[model samples]
Structures are given as structure tokens and as C-alpha cells.
Target: MQAEIGLIGLGTMGSNLALNIAEKGHDIAVFNRTTAKTGAFFEAAGALRSKIIPCTTLEEFVGAIRPPRPIILMINAGEPVDDQIEALKPLLSHDDILIDGGNANFHDTIRRNLLLDGTGLNFIGMGVSGGEVGARHGPSIMVGGAQASYKRVEQVLLDISAKYEGQACCAWLGENGAGHFVKTIHNGIEYADMQMIAEIYGIMRDGLGMQAKEMAPVFAGWNEGRLNSYLIEITAAVLDTEDAETGKPIVDIILDRAGQKGTGRWSAIEAQQLGIPATGIEAAVAARSLSARKDEREAAEKAYGALGETLKRDAGPLEDLELALLAGKIAAYAQGFAVMSGASGDYKWDLPLPEIARIWRAGCIIRSQFLSTIAEAFEGAEKESNLLLVPAFVEMMSEAQAGLRRVVARAATAGLPVPALSSALSYFDMYRQGRGTANLIQGQRDYFGAHSFERIDRPGAFHGPWAMNAG
Candidate 1:
């Protein structure tokens, strides 16, 4: 099949992705609400622009592309996706492909897939990451849908993706919603990672009284170490630059209000629904919410007055603390993955978690050295669902839990809000502890309702009033 792609919504990510495809020598038909944006891409790409057909109307966009046409939707998630699908439905035929390349709720993706099933239109939920720059270059792509449909466009996707061990950055992440689910959790992990960096920044600024410029080298140095990641590397660059207008640090002058498009929140909510504790991801969500409430927090702080002294800079080694934080973050990510894995089982997607982790190692915001370890754990597992109990990961968590606890304690003492990271660590501790307060509540329920509690010894067998009376 000759590669001809159609892209809707010519925003930052979309325009870049479209340009990347065009640069790679594929015919691309681009559309935007405002036709001017499409022209901007044409002018920027110049002579290579002939490869792209700019369309203003939905009908024109659909008509311009070839049959079995692959349309990449880069619009905002939620209603915009629905609106685009509805608008495009009339123009599409059987066996046509629609790819959502935005941060959308996985459940919605599953719902949309089911809706389009008999219509003969194939829906692909793709998790695209690497931000604007990565989109223009090559970003890690996670795709989930019909394998046959994936195979048809695999080469095109590969051509536009970042490389990994001679394998394409794109993978058939399973059926229906798996791609978006992995992406959702990816954003969740991203939330935790960013919050961890922020916490580190807080420690550096508040504890060490180091300026952003002074801390930039420390992060840059860490980037060369195991802590090296896209986020950390970029953060160092961000720290190095200053705003010309403010003369103050660029980062400091920027507003504390963090923006979200609800993917992280969706992941956390889905985890709760699936009975999975995604504490790290949830903490990240909470951290963003807290960031949005800067005024409220300031008021509360002012009312409380001076509470305590600054943290004493101990001459102790921070290697253990860093290790513990890394482990806790890893556990949090594992828990989030487990939630998605469980959803896959229930949704019948049969997603390969190892591949999901491996693909996330580059071009994605949450890309980190830690994902390699996760991929290893998933690879060694007898079953995909057995990721959390993998021996190496378990050992790593065990080694780091103590340090994580200490770090959380220190943060709390310093009156710093490390909600996301701390919550993730707490969730990890609770998951591994083998006993939680919830179990006590369950015991109470069994005692009151004759709900038939199983002894730890008996395991799966249920015991009720009949067994008690007989005994």
C-alpha cells in the first residue's frame, strides 16, 4: 500500500507530525478549523510542501486522501474527538482507518471502537509522546487496534517513529483501548516523575538555598548517571536559561499553576474502579491540583505563620535516598501498569506490558532508565499480570522502601507538600505490607454480615455461619 496519510487539527503536535510524515516522503492531506494554519505548514516545508494537500473542509480532507485512508486525529480529547468522528463518519467507507493521536480516556477509545466495529471502519487508539519537538522529529508511538490494520500501516508508522533495537517505535498494543490505556498510565507516571523533579528542586532551593542555575548542573550531571531521562535533561536546559524581562530565573517567573488535560486524572480514576491502587499517579494528579490552588495555599501558609526551622543539611549520603525514591516511583508505575493490565484482561485486549514499557523508554515524557527494568520484569513473568511480584522489582522496592519513608518524613517535617511522590511510596508500602486497614474493615464486614471470610491459612475457601455452627 502506498503511504498517504490525512491529519486533522493542525495544532503544534499535529503540524509537526504532519511535517515529519511529509519530510519522510509520504503524501499527506492536512486539515484545520482555520485554513490559514494549514498554509503555514505548506510555507514552512516549502518545495516538500507539494507532498501535502491542504483542506479546509472535512469532506475535502476525506476526499483528498486515498482509499483505506489513514486519518490521524490530533484534536483535543473528549468531545472534540467525538465531533470529528461524527463529522468524518459520512465521508468514510468500510475498511477505512481512524487514528486518535491525542491524550484520551482509554475507556472512551474502547467505546468508540465498539461503535465502529460493524461499520467496517477500523479505529486505532495511539498513544503519542515526545511533545512538540519529538512530534516533529520522531516520537515513541503506542498503537492498539486490529492487528491486520496495524500490519497494513506498520511500515509508515515505523518510518516516522524513533528506533529501538532495530524494531519500530510502534507496537500493536492489543485490541481497542490498550494503546490509550498504556498512554494514560504513561501520563500518570509522567505526573509522578515531574512532581519528583519539582520536589528535588524544592529541596535544592529551600534546603540548599541553591538557585535554579546552580541546580541545573546537578540535574545535568544526574542525566549522565542512572537518573538520566528526557525530562531531567530538558529540566537542566530550562534551569540554565533566564527570562530577559524579569531578570529573575525563568522558571521562578513562570506561574506555579500546572495545566492538565485529564489523562492523569482518568488513569487514577480507572485504577480506583479496577481496584488497583495507583498512588504515585494519583499523587501526581493531586500535586497538579495543589499547584492550581497557589492562592489558597499561600493564604493558609500566611494564617499558619512561621512553623519551623529549615531542614538541617546532614553530611549523610543521599545515594540511598535517591535509590529509595527511584524504587518508590517504580512501584507506583508498576501499580499503574497493573491497573491497565487488569483492564486489558477484563476488556479482552491481551496487551503485552513488556512491549508497552519498552516503547515508553524514548520519545515519551515518562521515558526513563526505569522503564527498562520494568520491561525486564514483564519479560521474565510467566504471565503478563504477574509484573508486580517479579523478584528483581520486589527486591528493589524492599531495598528502597526504608529510604523512601525517611524522605517522606523529612519532607513532611519541612512543611513541603510532596503529595504525589509520598502517596505513591505509601501505596507501595501498603501493597507490600500484606496487611492494610482495609483488611480490618473487611474482617468487620465478615463478622457482621456473615460475608464468609476466608482464613489466611484456608486461603480461597469461604467460611460462614454454617461452618461456625458445625464446628
Candidate 2:
């Protein structure tokens, strides 16, 4: 009996995904650059060995699968993916499917799709989220490719996808790059969420003189309520873990330098290029960049002083921090979706915003009860670009904005860095204003760059000489 599908790359994600497929009763043929990894996988497979056909080379991997074959590339993004596809291109027949399940830049996906346009071999840029454990169990699958190609493998994809309430958290977002684009923006929002949480943690530690032990229960409590999420739950667990040697909180001993694999930066960059304000996401990216300059920070601390050492802790406002977090979260999601909405129109992807929200409600890292509200908000709407304008979210924002304002004020006064939270509040205020200070910017642009500005009173573009620079 031939395997129904094939996978190339037996890394953690790929191997687990193959196991999942095999467990679902679908025979899978898998290949890897290093045959040793494949050997190890087969050994671990044990009873499942009969289900997974191990292949040492691309030709063998292709030969093992059935016709109209769907092969997933869980390999690294960029040139490596191209290399694999090029090697597999000669072997794959017409109507065969090639799926890229990695954190690829959406632009690259579009380019690759364009490159494979006339080849007859289909290309799918798919996003798989939920980390290592999620792979072994099930992961949220976001697919973007030709609709016909997607139709061919829909059932198999659905079978392997994470299910919530008996429905798969997988769907075809659009053709060419939509899935990766959505995933990119998803990571951006994740960065904002994590940064805001860290800012709150900062408030607890330095601002309120609370230790990890004292603060862990607070996160655990939050997880039981509106903030219930995998990230928050794991954060509490991370804080709860103590080092084996000194018994100090593991997080305290860990370096503050956070690592990123570029998706968050891409999200911020795309938003900026689109002329959309994703300040919350942008702030998070900037914070990580700043954190990376550990030496400079140490020097600055030595030369000047630590903000925590200098600033006085006024009110802890633990409950207010929760409210502020919720507000920031709403704003972050609003911005992320706004970017997606803009891209959908610009690229004519016709992305289903509501469906995207639905899939994200579970199986992804950013999964939260809040996503349900987001889905509901999008579903009930007449289709708008921004989530904040949705009636449900509008009311929620109105009620919770005060908390955001108060928290930002407290953090500012305490000389604490709350860039993500501050940016969210600023974005909210900027979004609500009928008239903003942008007129001065327009005037300056026209004065310096000869870029004409449109007058609100009339409809024509106008330029400012400004009294010939008072010469």
C-alpha cells in the first residue's frame, strides 16, 4: 500500500507532523537530509513504523507517495525551501502539491508562487502554529494557495489540523501568501502581547517590590479569568520554576535578551509601508531591539542610574494593570487586523477576516477567550478594516480605556518602560481624534519636500511657501 502523503524534513516539527498524520491512519513517506534523523524517527515510531515510509532521498520520497501527490516541506524558509523544491520539481508530476510549512516572509511566498505558476506543480504557503507539542497533537493550519490545489488536499489537511469544538482550526485564507501574511502579523501581535505582559511584570517587580513568587499567583489568577491563555498560563509556570542550584527564580537568572526570528519585524515593516499605525507591534519590536543592546544598557545604567532605583513607586494598581492589559490587547489585535484588511484589498486576496479570527480562537500561541469576542465582532460587522470600530469592541474599549490611561500615567511617573502599553493608548487616542496635529506635519512636508498637502476646507492640494521662509 502506498502512502497517501509525503513529508520532506524530519526536524522536530516535521517528524511530529508525520507522526500525527500516521496516527490519523494516513500513511506518510518522510525524507531528511541526514538519514540518521530518519532512523531515529523510525525507531521512535515503533508500532507506527508500518504507517510511515522512511525515504533517504527526494526521488525515493516522491516515488513512495500516490498520484496527485501532496508533499509538505517543513524545511527552513528562504533559499533552503527553494533548493528543496527545485530538486523535487524534476520528479513531481503535473497536479502534484508542494506545501511550505514554515515562517516564510509573505513576499517570498508570492514570488515563489509566481515562479511556479506555469510548472503545473502546485505551491501552497501554509502556516502551522502551536509549537512542538502542538505538532505532535495538532496545530492550527492556515493555508494559502490556488483554490483547486487546496480542494485536493482539504480533507487530509483538516484531519491533521487542531480541532476546537469539533471544528478544525484550519482554513484556506486566500491564494498566494495570505496564510504566511496572517501568520506574520500573528507573531507581531504576539510580540506586543508578550511585551505588555513584561511591562506589567516590571510594574510588579520594581514598581511594587513584588517577587516572582508573589507575582506568579497573580498570573495564575488572571489565567482563570478574561486573560485566560496558553502564554499567560505558561508564564505563570515559568515564574513558578526555581533553579536547582541556588533555588533562585529561573526567570531572574535568565538574560533579558529576547530572541526573534524576523516575523514581528516584518509585520511592523509591512504595516509602516502600508501607512497603517501598528504602534503597539512596532513598540514591541523596538523594545526587543533595545533589549539586545545589553552592553549599552549596562553602561547607561552605570553612568546615569537605574530608573527603578530613582523613581518612586506610588500606587501598585494591580487590578488597573489587568484592565490596561485587556485594553492594550484589544488595540494590538485591532491594529493587526487592520493591516490584514489593508493587505487583502491591496493584493485582492479577499481574505476572510472573520474566519481568520475563528481559527485563531484556538490551537495558536495567542489563543485566548478574547479571540472569541474578536470573531463575534468580525462576524456581526458589515465588514470594516478596523476591529476597534466594531460595536462590541467599541463599547469594551470605551469602558476599559480609563484603565489604560491610568496605567500609562502611573508607568510614566514611575519612570518605567511600558512602550507597548503606551503605544496602544496613544494609538487609541489618535484613532478617536476628529482633528489631530498632523496638519503641522503636512505643512512641514510641503515646505521641505514640495509634497503638496490637501486642504480640509476644499478638495485641492495646496503648497506652503510660508512667507518665503521669512527672508
Candidate 3:
């Protein structure tokens, strides 16, 4: 019997995804550049091995799948992916679909889509989230390509995707690069969400004089409330763990610095290009960059004397911390969705905002009960309206903003760094202001360069009289 689908790159993600497809009753042919790994994977498959056709060569892998094939490339995102696509072009026949399943730069995805145009081979830039565990079981799949091409593989994708209340967390997002773009923004929100949580952790540790064991229950308790999510649940679990060798908290034994791939940075860049204020994501990216300069930070801390240690004080009630986190999260998600909205307009993709939120309600790292609220907000929202402006969110922000303000004020006084949270608060403040201070900036620009400014009283652009006095 012929295999239903073929997959390349039997790395961690690829191997797990292949198993998931097979477990869901689809025969999958899999290949790796190192032929030994393919055999090793098949050997490890055990009961599911019967459904896997291990292929030693690209030709064999392509041939194993039936005609008008659907092949998923789970390779690295850059040149390696391009190389694989080029190698497969000759081996693949007309109507064979190629799916790029990686954390790709959407721009690159668009280029590859255009490159494969009229080749009779369909190209899909698919975004797969939920890491190793999600791949082995189910993942949230974001597919982008021709509608017909997506329909060909839709059932298989649905079968392998996570279910939220029995509905699959997968959808054909748009054409060309939309899936990757949304995934990039997802990572951005993840960074912001994590950074805010870390800021709260910093407050608990430095200001409240709390240890990991003491903080564990706090986060665990928050998980049962509005902040209930996978990240919170795991945060509680991680804090409770101890290092076996040293008997110290496992988190204390771990390195302070964090590592990042390019997705968070990409999200910031794309937001700036589209003129959207994704300050929460930007602050998180900047914070990560600062964290990476560990040597410089250590030297500076020694020179200036450590402030985090000296600023120990009361951090207010735990309820305030929880509310602050929720508010910051709302701002971060709002900015992420705003960036997506801007990109949709720029690309003419006509992305379904509500559907995007609905699909993200499970499987992804940032999946949470909060997303259901976002989905509901988008359902009744005007096309160009911001999430902050949505009535439900306005009511939420009204109730929650006070807690955020108090948290920021306390963190500021205690000299604790709360970049993402503070940035979110600032974005919220600026966005809601009917008249901002930017008119002075416009006046400065006009005075120096004769650049025009628009009067609020009138529609057309006008120059400031300061240009007349410039020599």
C-alpha cells in the first residue's frame, strides 16, 4: 500500500510529527539526510512502525508517497529549506504540494511561494506550534497557500491538530506567508507574556523577600484564576522543583540569561514597518538583548552596587500582582493582534481575526482561557478597531488598570526592572489619550524642516509659522 504523505528532515520535531500522523491512521514516508537516523526512528516506532515507510533517499521518499503527493518539510528555516525545495522540484510531479513547517520569516516564505509559481507544484508555508510534546500528540497548525491545495490536506491536518472543545486548532490562515507571520506575532506575544511574568517573579523575590518554594503556591493559585494558562501552570511546577545534586531550587541553579531565536525580533521589526505600537513585544526583545550581555551586566552591577539586592521592601498584596499580570497580558495580546491586523491590510490577506483567536485557544505555548475572551471581542468588533477599544476589553481594562498602575509605581520605587509590564501600561495610557503631546513634536519638525503638520481644526496639512523665522 502506498504512503499517504511524505516528510523530510527526521529531527526532533519531524520525527514526532511523523509519529502523530501515523498514529492518526495515515501512512507516512519519512527521510533524513543522515540515512541512519531514519532507520533509528523506524526502529523506535515499535507498534506504529508498520505505518512508517523509511526511505534512504529523496527519490525513494517521493516515490513512496502516492501521486499528487503532499510532502511536509520540517527542516531548518533558512537556506537549508530552499536547498531542500530545489532538490525536490525535479523529483516531484505536477500538483504535488510542498509544505514548509518551520519558524520561517514570512518574507522568505513569500519569496519561495513566488519562486514556485506556475511550476504545477503547490507551496504551503505552514506554522506548527506546541513544541516536541505537541508534535508527538497534537499541535496547532496554521496553513497558508492556495485554498484548493489546503483542502487537499485539510483532513490530515485536522486529524493531527489539537482539539479545543472537540474543534481542531488548525486553519488555513491565508495565502503565501500569513501562517508564518501570525506565528511570528505569536512568539512576540510569548516573549512579552514571559517577560511580564518574570518581572512579577522579580518583584516577589527582591521586594517581597520570597524564595522559590514560597512563590510556587502563589503562581499555582494564580493558575486557578484569570491568569490560568500553560505558562502559569508550568511556572508553578518549575518553581516547585529542586536540583537533585545541590538540593537548591532548580531555577536558582539555571543560568540567568535567556536564549532567543529570531521570531520575537521579527515580530518587532514587522510591527515597526507597519507603524503599529507593539511596545510590549519591543520591550521584551530589548530586555532579552540586555540579558544576553551577562558579562557587561555583572561588571556594571559591581561598579554601581547591586540595586536588586538593596531595594528589598514590601511588594503589595498578591492579588495586585495577579491583576497587574493580567492587564499586561491583555496589552501584549492586543498589540500582537493589532500588528496582525495591520499586516492583513498591507498584504490584502483578509485574515479572519476571530478565527485566528479561536485557533490559538489551544496547543500553542500562549494558549489560555484569555484567548476565548479575545475571540469573543473580535467577533463583534469593527474591522479597523483596536482590541483596547472593544467594549468587553474596555470594561476589563477599566477594572484592571488600577492594579497595573499600582504595580508599576511600586516596582519603580523599589528600583525593580519591570520593562514589559511598564511598557504595556505606557502603551495603554498613550492609546487611550484623546490628545497626546505629539503636536509639539510636529511643531518641532515643522520649525526645523518646513515639514507640514495638520491642524486639528482643519483637514488639510499646514506648516507652522516658525518656518518664516528660519534664516
Candidate 4:
């Protein structure tokens, strides 16, 4: 009963996280359904094994932790989480805290919290980002629960989180579902980011007639500037790597189809339901769906005739592609944050936008130099203003949007697919406009459905009596 924290599930993430905690000098109790896993972990733990108490059974695991315990669940999401909660609750006392560190749907977090209302068990829905290696080292941690409940394990979380400029990339974002909601939206932005990069790569491949080796240097160069990020760094490595057996770029050997595990789609669906226009994410998800329909694409290619090996190479003035990528990134972040802002207000979360930006500065898939700029913008702006309206970002958009316009136009004429970039450009354009063409939509709805439209000269809704006299 000397362990400070107890963890269940011995999956890759769970095992690595348990090792991290133990190496951090915290006495932790670990349990897996299979006893052999627990045995193997201790054998591999080396010097850190002394701090880890491996229990063969759940009951033994529960008894190993001290009072006012914090039990973390790093299992699969969906029904597994719900089922595990029911199984573990009987073993936990009223003062215990259960933390879900998996990528969960926020609504499910809210529902679970609601279900455990008076049970006296504290539920913390935490979003742990960065992949397997990050879990073993330090990942950005987003916590959503009561302040008191967060306080109980704050030090441990901070200690295990990645640091950016001497600050921990971890914080309590809000209460119930807020953390997972932020993570879902983060994945949404990640989708847009990856897709935009892939679209740019498509241009380099088809339009420029450049190989992966040629493009690797380009991505590497971008990493030295404002676009420097984990994704960019990794993209360079991935593209530059050659398949040893085939003697070709590894990327060329890989399948064109992209795989997704729901978070990106969920974010897009959530944004649509919330009536927040996250078009970049939406376009990215759609692009993935298009990629997945391989047979249909093959049939279409056969019917339409494939566009030969080399494009005419006339997508000129492409020196500003970096600027275009930057602009698209800004648009994606702007849309994502807007969705977050809407959710914050709708759910009364009062999420710390600046803090969110700060935490995202490191240890996350989207970590970048641009995040510091975002943090500064949020720190200086009125809470009601969008990122595009921030002074510095306004200047960025003013300078960069012209380049974005040029790139999108060139890609379009070159017959290159740039859906994410094109959609991002459109979103930015729509956001800054005072008047839009939706007035025609209003008129059409009124004419057909008698929905009525508001008049600029008058206060009330009005309908045209265009055919009354003739009828």
C-alpha cells in the first residue's frame, strides 16, 4: 500500500507510461490482465523495477495504492472504457480519482461524468498526445476535471510532461470532456496539416517532376523557418529514406491510401453539428475518404485516361509555396481555435486559449514555432476576437494571402489537386468579408419556403410580393 499511483492496462502506451512514472522516482502500482506481461515488464524495467510494484490481479493492484488514490486507465476507447469503469468502481473508494488518458470522444466523457454524479468518484478526462515514443518520454497532457481533483496529481503530471522554454506542456483545461474535445480538435487540425503537406507534395511530384529525394531537401529547408515543426522534420526523414530492397524512396513504395481512426472524422462531424465552419479539416477528411476509395479511383482513371507521366511543368511562380503552406496552416489553426472557442462558450468551459497554445508549443504532433505566435496573439487579444483579427496575424495574412492566392491558382490550372489549400484560402477569404453572396440563398429560401428575409432598411422580416398582383 505504499505506491502513490496505480495504473491498469499494459498496452504499449500504458507500459511506457508506467515506466516513465517509475523512472521519475514515483512509486507506482501496475497491473495487466495477463500475469506474464507484468512479469516481462519488471524484467525489462532494469533499475526502475525497484520502484514499480507489479500486481498479478486487479484486487492486488487496488490494495497496493495508498489512500485518496489516483487510478489511471490507458485502455482502448469506446465501450472498453465504459466497461472498465464499471469493473474498477467497486474496488475504488469515494475519494479515489479515475483518469482516462486515452483519446475519447468528449461527449462520452461528459456522459460518463454525468453517470457517476453522486458516486463520489472523481473523473478526469485527460488528452495525452504525441505518439508511442512521446508516451515513453514526455507528452503534452490536457486535463479536464475539477480544480481540486486536478490539484491532487498536478505535480506528477507536470513532472512527466514535455517542457517548452522551461514551462510544462500540461494544464487543466476545463471540466469534463473539455480536454478530449481539445484533443479531437487537435487531430482535426493535424489532418488538415498532413493533407496540405501531401497536396504540396503532389504538386512537387506531378507538376514539378521532382522525386522524393528532391522534395526532402525542400521540407528540410522549411523546418529552419516559421514552418519548423515535428511533422515537417519527420516528413523530411520519411521522404529522404530509401527502401533498402527496392533502391527507391520509401514513400514511393508505400500505399497511397491513408488510414484514420475516427478522431478526425469526429472533429469534422462535431464542427458541422456545432455550426462552426472547419472547412480545412472537412476537406482533409474528404480527401482521405477519396483516397480510401481505391477501386473507384482506379475505374475513374481508366475511364478518364491517366494524365501521363509528366505535367508540362508550368506551375510557375511557385517560390511562394512556403508562404502558401504557412497561410493554409494559419487558416487551419484559426478554424480549429474558432471551433474550440465556440465549444468553450457553448459548454461554459472558459478554456484558457493562451494556455492551450502554450502547451501545444511542444510534445504534440502539431508543435511548432507558430504556436508561440498564437500564444502571444491570444495573450494580447480580446477574448471575443478570432485569431485572424489579432494584430500580428492580421499582418501575416495581409502579406501571405497574396502568395496563397497565387499558389492555389497555379495548382488549379496545372490540374493538381489542392483541396486543403484551396479550401483554406476560401475559408480565410470568407472570414474577412463583411458581405457575402449568401443573400441569394436567403432569397431562394424565402421564395420557396416563405422563410422570409430581414430587410436592411426595416427592422422586421419581409417577403417579396412579386407575383401577388399577377396571380
Q: Give the better candidate number (2 or 3) by TM-score.
A: 3
lDDT of 1 at 454: 62
Q: What tens digits encode model 2's per-residue C-alpha lDDT throughout 311-363?
A: 34444487788889889999999999999989999989988887888888778
Stretches of candidate 3 off by over 4 Å are 308-315, 381-384
The collision pairs in model 2 are none
TM-score for candidate 4, please give it.
Answer: 0.96
Candidate 4's error at 380, in angstroms? 1.6
**What is the descending lDDT order?**
3, 2, 4, 1
Local distance difference test, each candidate = 0.80, 0.89, 0.91, 0.89
Q: Write the per-residue lDDT of candidate 1 for residues 269-343, one digit (tens) a residue.
A: 988888877787787788898889988978987999744646666533255446645665676677778887788
> Which should have the higher lDDT, number 3 or number 4?
3
Per-residue CA lDDT of model 4 for 287-314, tens digit only, reads: 9999999999999989988765444454
Per-residue lDDT tens digits of candidate 3, residues 1-471? 789999999999999999999999999999999999999999999999999999999888999999899999999999999999989999999999999999999999999999999999999999998999889888888888888999999999999999999999999999999999999999999999999999999888887888999999999998998889988999999999999999999999898899999999999999999999999999999999999999999998899877653333544457789889999998999999999999999998988888889888888899988788788777763643788887777888898999999889988987889999999999999998999999999999888988889998879989976677887
Report lDDT (Cα) of residue 449, candidate 2. 76
Clashing pairs in 4: none
TM-score on alpha carbons, each prediction: 0.91, 0.96, 0.98, 0.96
